[model samples]
Target: MLKTVRSVSIADYAKSGVLILPLLSSRKRKAEERRGKTVRKKGQERLLQGNEAIVEGALRAGCRFFAGYPITPATEISELLSVRLPKVDGTFIQMEDEIASLGAVIGASLAGVKSMTATSGPGFSLMQENLGFACIAEVPCVVVNVMRGGPSTGLPTSPSQSDVMQARWGTHGDHPMIVLCPSTIRECYDLTIKAFNLSEKYRNPVILLVDEVIAHMREKIILDGDKPIDIFTRVKPTVPPEWYIPYEDTPTGIPAMADFGEGYRYHVTGLTHDTRGFPTSRPDEVDAFIRRLFRKISQNFTDMQMGEVFQTEDAEVAVIAYGCVARSAKRAVIDARERGIRAGLLKLNTIWPFMRTQVEKILHTSGCVIVPEMNMGQISREVKRVNKGTAKVFTINKVDGTIITPQEILGKIREVC
Candidate 1:
């Protein structure tokens, strides 16, 4: 015989029956199911503008301090973060100019908060001096440069890859730099995270380059909130405040940073300084300081160098491009293959600390290489330097404040083949 089963509430026991508490009510159960769906849906794809993706990626990477001036193409980053940051207990400040913007970012980073700023070509030019200071201080921060045509405000509302060289070399002196070029909305998100990670890991400045087309264009990207991301954080001093040396020499070549208010007595200056953070003009100490700054990057070239090789295996003609131009070149490579041409494309995601090894590899495999840029062939100059007349290299350069087209790249490929 089956035993009888009865469901009773705790209230029934108080009245005169058994004390049985229900775990949940029908209303509560339904509410939980809806919440589960919302959480799962965050892992699905969403249509996002490129700058929006940058904002999302930065928050995902744990950036809590944002200081920047409003500029075309990249304005949405600061505007959106103004509203989003406070909700997460983060700080957002709009500076009077780009110069002040990067300054505040550096100050925030020194206080132990991950920081970033955004601007266009003109504003980027203004920040170069401060960028150099951050380099000497070894402060970690990210700068997002939305490429607009210009030497000095040529095309504020148009797209141009003219800032390629400036992103790497605009700052004064021979400072070590890391610049990332993202060609898609997904890359805009992914690379921004990588930029912050690199900055933190190396204790250096990192720049993420996008263009007007990339900044405003929309694309479907799965920025999965549930997915695990590889984030690198700045190493802090392990020793007590009395023993802390902000710029102490380490085997990894990266000095540990301490928060400003943590009672760590350390100096910070723009001048070439000794490990004690004090200015030293002695040849031995100056040489050591500069060498260590570059050594941090040189020692880790294997991990820092990044690029994508598409259809380059056994190809006769290869096109080297970055940013949105890479998109056109990708299509051109496919079109060339359709017409029975052995054409390939090398898309660079890391622009600086130039991929000499990878570029040489492509040069060896291909008879001819073409570099298409929206500038007057800045990167092509670097390619030619590495080629050194070993390969037939050509360039497709445009500086009329426009982007390179697939037809332009395909025509060059066909001609070369």
Candidate 2:
């Protein structure tokens, strides 16, 4: 009953004329246990930079193609993907410039791959044209813009949220966009996944806005290995190749996307096109195309809008903010509450289509809405527009490349209260 288990070499087994099947099986089981332990270790919680979290999130979302150029505060994303993407059988390309980066991404997405690209402010400016093209052509892709102090490469390493307006309206034409801003490292991961999902579901591009402060800063995060993430892939055409129309409008306003070389040969162009995907200069066709593009996003904004409200139910003063600046606002609200002031925070995780209903509710209920941002009141203007004389809107702005601290926001809360 006390038989000992010992390792036997292949040579020893052959010399002793013994069957080595049992010993080989034992070794295989031990090896598998060691591998399982290694995998578990790899999946355990660890500290991660925001940029690194973004790369992990994209990979988890089944992103198979990435094309981006080197840019500050965002180059790390491209670098990490270069190594990790190959491991997942994905492709990574360093394009000649930001324009080509987005072009390559659009091409890859058209080829039926979930693709993404990352850049900072300067590079972001360069990609606006193609961004609009992705919108008009109904190509689903994700673009990450890491904010840095900028107006033509102002400060590459410094944090600034000056691109809020640009993220919304940088392109030339009247197009709809969904922009998600994350306040923490964990949010950087979660929102990037959401960006991909929303883009695919809507058949348009989605922007993930990250500032320098969050992008480069390191923080510990608990990544739940058991949590299931909902992934949305583009709907493929069910009809035969001859019956497929790439731009066939549906009730949902999203057309079925057919991959190239899938027997569905359809045209795609940045110009206004018809259901068959051919360019049309007719005014009615152009009008219909534009309206459908806008309707797809504007009508479905309710499903796309996501926000967080803390202590807002009965508060007299509500603070509305987003991005990394919202972190300070949350702390300010908690501190104000401790000091017997009824203060709350409305954190906008989805910045575009502007949370009009939530802001209206907050304005009607609260005596005043205080918006503190790192930029010069870009979103505060939207808050004021939504408030519409119902409540006084106050903005606290800082654009000096420094983060808006909690104490600064608390002071504003005290003053407003």
What's the lDDT of the predicted structure labeled candidate 2? 0.86
TM-scores, all candidates, are 0.90, 0.89
lDDT at 347 for candidate 1? 84
Model 2 — TM-score against the truth? Answer: 0.89
- Cα misplacement distance, residue 2 of candidate 1 (Å): 67
lDDT of 1: 0.86
CA lDDT of each prediction against the hidden true structure: 0.86, 0.86
**True lDDT of residue 125, candidate 1:** 96
What's the residue-level lDDT of 141 in candidate 2?
A: 99
Q: In candidate 1, which residue ranges exceed 4 Å CA deviation?
A: 1-43
Listing every candidate in turn, what is its Cα RMSD in Å to the true structure after a full C-alpha superposition?
13.6, 12.9
Candidate 2 colliding pairs: none
- Kindly list the per-residue Cα lDDT of model 2 for residues 1-417, writing each as its tens digit: 011112223343222211222223556656865765322224346578999989988998889999999999899999999999999999999999999999999999999999999999999999999999999999999999999987898887789888989999999989999999888788888889989999999998999999988898777665646456698999998999998878877888999999988888889998889888898999988888899999999889887898877778888999998887887787777778778998877888899978898889889999699998888889999988877799999999998889999899999888977
Model 1 alpha-carbon miss at residue 308, Å: 1.1
Superposed by TM-score, candidate 1 places the C-alpha of residue 253 at a distance from the truth, in angstroms, of 1.0
